[model samples]
Target chain A: MFRKYRKKSPWILHYNAGSCNGCDIEILAALAPKYDLERFGVINTGNPKQSDIFLVTGPVTFRSRERLVELYTQMPEPKVVIALGSCTCTGGVFRDMYNVEDGIDRYIPVDVYVPGCAASPELLIDGVVKALEILEEKTKAIEKPFRLFKEASSENGIINRRHSALKVGEKDEED
Target chain B: MSKKTIHIPLGSQHISLLEPVRFKFECENEKIVGVDSDVGFVHRGIERACTTKFKFDAIGYVVARVCGLCAITHSLSYTVAIEKLLGGEISKKAKYLRILLLELDRIHSHMLCLSHTCENAGFEAMFMRIMGDRELVMEIQELLTGNRIQFDYISIGGVNRDLDVQTAKKIIENLALVKAKVFSYIDEFTNNWSLSLKFKGIGALTLEDAYRFNAIGPLARACGLPIDVRNEIEYLPFDEVGFKMQTHNDGDINARNMVRLNEILNSLEMCENILRGLPEGEIFTKLKGKPKGEALMRFEAPRGELMYYVKGDGSAMLNRVRIKTPTFACIPAFSHIFMGEEYADAPAILASFDPCLSCTAK
Candidate 1:
C-alpha cells in the first residue's frame, strides 16, 4: 500500500559535483513552469534521507567525491541515481582535467544517463521518467523475500558469506 | 555588555546555495561579525586546461566553459583578445550580433539572480514567477544562438551564425513580454511590504564600502558607483548598440534588485535596436597568421567586468591565459557586506550579491 503512494512522489536531491552551472540551471528550468517536472510529483528536496532519486550534475571533482559517496549512502535503500548532462555522464568536455574524476558513476551507481552539453529540459525530464521506473524496480527487489542458505561447516542457519542465495541481478528462476 | 559569540558554518553543501560555497560566520547574538568563505570546491583547473590542453583558436569555446551563465561573454572576450593579437578586424554585422547575444545573456543571468534572491528570501511564488518568465529570454537565446546555456556563438574572426528575420521577430515578441514582466517585478520588489521588510535596509553596502572593497557589476552600481566596463571598452561598440548603465544609490538588496531590473530594461532596448538596424554585411571575417604578442580584452559580463589577458608566442599553444572573473574580484566585497547583518538574512544577502562560485573558483 505504501509502495504505490511512494512511487507517485519521489523527491530529488540535486548535487553539483563540479559543473559549470549549465546543467544546474537546466535542472531548474525543468522544474520551472515551462517544463513543469513537478506536475509528476517530483520535489527538489535537499535532505538525502527523504529523497528517493538523486540528480547529480557536472563531473565528480576530487573535492566532491567524498561528499557524493556520503550523500548516496545516506539515502535509504531502493533509490535511483540519475546523472544529468554530458559532463556528468562521461565528463564530456571536462574529461581528463586533473581535478575531475571523469563521472559520478565512479563513486555511485547511475541508473539513468541524460546526455547533452547541458542536458536540455526534455532530456532531463526523460531521464527522471526512466528513473521512476528504476526506482519502482529497486523497491520491488527490496521487498521480495529470500530464503537463507546453510553453510557446509557453520552450525547456525545464517546465510554463508560466500554461498549467499541473494544475487543482485539474478532472477528468481535462477534458484 | 558584550555577549558570547557563536560560530556557524553555512554550506560546503546546502539547499540555499546552488553551488558549493562555504561560509563560516562568527555571530554575536544573531548579528554576524566576521565571515570566512571557501570558494574552491568547483575549481576544475580550467586555467591549467587552457594552457596545456586547448589550442589558440579552440580556446575561445574552451573558455566559454568557465561559466555557463556568461559563456558567450567568456568566448567573445577571449575571441576578441585573440583577434587583437592576430591583428584581425571583424565585420560590423558580427559586432552587432555579438552584442545582441551578450545583452540577452545579461538579461537571463540577472533574471536568474533575482529569482534566486527571491527564493532565498522565502518568496517561493516570486521565485517561480521570475523563473517562469525567464524562459522567454532563454527561448530567445536558443532561437538566436542555437543553444540555451553554452552557446559557442562567437568565433575568433566573427560569429558562427547570422540572424534571420523569423528569429528577429521572435526575439522582439519575447523581449516585449519579458519587459512587461520585469516592470511588474520592479513594482512588486518595491511596493510589496513583506519583501521590503526582507530586502530594504538589509545587507546594506554603503558607497564607501563598495569603493574600499572594489565591488563590481550591480553590486557597485547599487551603491551609485559608475564603474561599468561597457562604458570603457571601445572595441565591442556597446555604445553604438544602445547599451546603457543602470545605477542606484541605496546599496541594499532592494537597490541591487532595482539596478538589475533597470539593466534588464536597457538590455532589452539594446537587443531590439540591434535587430531593427542590423547592418547587412559578413557575419565572420577570415583572419590570417598566428597570434604572436600579448593582448588584453575587457567586456561587461552580466555579473560585472570580465577581463581576459592572453600572451601568445606565435604558436598553436598559448603562453598564458588569465581570466579575472567578476565574482572572484568581489570576494572581498561579498565578505564585507555580510558583516553586521542579521544571521537570518545571510542567505538573502548572499543571494542578492549574485555570487558565482564556479566563476570565482575557476
Candidate 2:
C-alpha cells in the first residue's frame, strides 16, 4: 500500500541536449493545462536526487553527453529514464550529424522510447505514466530502509561513476 | 539592485523561437545592454551541395526548401537566374503567373509574421484571427501550385502549372476580401493604444543605422530608404503591373509591422494587375546548349534582395554555388537594434525583423 503511494507520485527532471527546440516546446506543452500530465502525478522536480524519472530530449551533442550522464546518475536507484523525441531515441533527423554523437541511450539506459520529430504532448504524458508503473514494481522489492540507502550515497561519487561508465559505454558501443 | 552586467546566453535552441542560432545577451539589472548573435548552426552546405549534388534542372526543387515561407520566391529566383544565364526567356504569361504566385507567398509570409508576433505577445485570439484570414492566401497558392506552403511550380524555363480561368477569378475575389480583412486588423492593431506603446519606440533602428548595418526588406524600408532590388534592377511585368512602395520614417517595431502590412496590400494589387495583363505564348524556351562559365544573379525576395553566384566550369555539374539570403544582411542590424532594451522584449524585438535563421544558417 505504501509502495502504491510512492508509485503514484514520481518526480521528473527535464534535460535538453542540443535539439532544434521542437521537442522542448512539446515538453512544455505536455505540462500545460491542456495536456496536464500533473493528473498522472508526474511532477517536474528541480533536484535530480529527488527525481524518480529523467526526461531527456535532443541528440546528445559531443559536449552535452558528459553532463547528461552526470544528471542521470544523480537520480536515485530504481529510477526510470524516458528518451523523449526521435532525436533522443535514435537521433532522428539529426542522426549522422557531424557534431552530435548519437542518441541519449548512447550515454544512459532508456526505459521508454517516445518517438516523433517530436512526440505529441498526450503521448508524452502517457509515456510518463508508464514509467511510474515500472518504478512501483521496484519499490515493493526494496522496501527495507530505502530512504536511508538513498541518503547514504554521496552525489559526487555517483557523478564520477557515471563519467567512467559513459567512457566505458562509448568504447563498448564503438567496439 | 546594483548595476551589474550579467552575461546570459540564449538560443542555439530557444523556447519561443524556431531555427537554431546562438544569442549572447549582456544584461544590466534585467535590461539588455548588448546582443551578440551567431546564425551558422544548420549550414547544410546546400549551395555547395546544389551545384555538385543536383543537376541544374532539379536545383529549383532543392532551392525551394531553403526557406519554407518563401519557397516559391527562391525557386522563381533560381529559375530566372538560370533562364538569364542560358539566354532563354519564359512566356509573357509564365512571367505574370510567377508574379501572381510570388504575391500570394508575400501575403502568406506577412500574415504569418503578424500572427506569430501576436502569439508571442500572449494574444492568442488575435493570432488565430490573423491565421484564419491567412488561409485565403494559402488556398490561392494551393489552387495555383497544388501545395499550400511549398509550391513546386517554377521550372527551369518557366512555370510547371498554368492558372486556369476559375482559379484566376477566385484569386482576384479572395485577394480583395483578404485585403479588406487585413486592413481591419491593421486598424485595430494601430489604434489599440497599448500595442502602440509596446511597439512604437521599441526596437528602434535609424535610417543611417539601417544603411550602415545593411538591414534589408522592411527593416530598411521602415527607415524611409527605398532600397528595393526590384526597383533597382528591373524585371519584366514590374513596370506594367504598377504597385506603390510603402515606407515609414520611424524605424521601430510598429514601423516594421506597418511596412509588412502595407506591402501585403500592394502585393494583392500587383497580383490582380498581373492576372489582368497575363499574355499568351509557349511557357518554356528549350535549353539546347550546355551552360558554360560562371554567372552571378540577384533577385528581390519578400524579405529583401537574394543573391546567387554560380560557377558552371563548362560541365553539366556546377563547380560552385553561393547564395546570400536577406537575413544574412540583417544580422548586424539585429545586433545593433537589440542594444539598450529591456530583456522582456527580446523575443518580440527579434521577431520584428522576421528573421529566418534557417536561411541564414544554410
In model 2, the clashing pairs are none
Model 2 DockQ, alpha carbons vs. true complex: 0.07
Model 1 residue B238 CA deviation in Å: 1.4
Candidate whose lDDT is highest: 1
Q: Which stretches of model 2 miss by more than 4 angstroms?
A: A1-175
**Any idea what lDDT model 1 has?**
0.90
Docking level for model 1 = medium
lDDT of 1 by residue, B1-362 (tens): 57889999998778888888889999999999999998999889888888899888888888888888889889988999999988988999999999999888999999999999999999999989999999999998888878889998989899998888898998899999999999999999989999999999998889998889989999999999999999998898888878777889999999999999999999999988988999999998999888899998888888899999999899999989999999999999999989899999999999998888888887
* Interface RMSD for each of the candidates: 0.8, 6.8
Q: Which segments of model 1 are wrong by more than 4 Å?
A: A150-175
TM-score of chain A of 1: 0.87
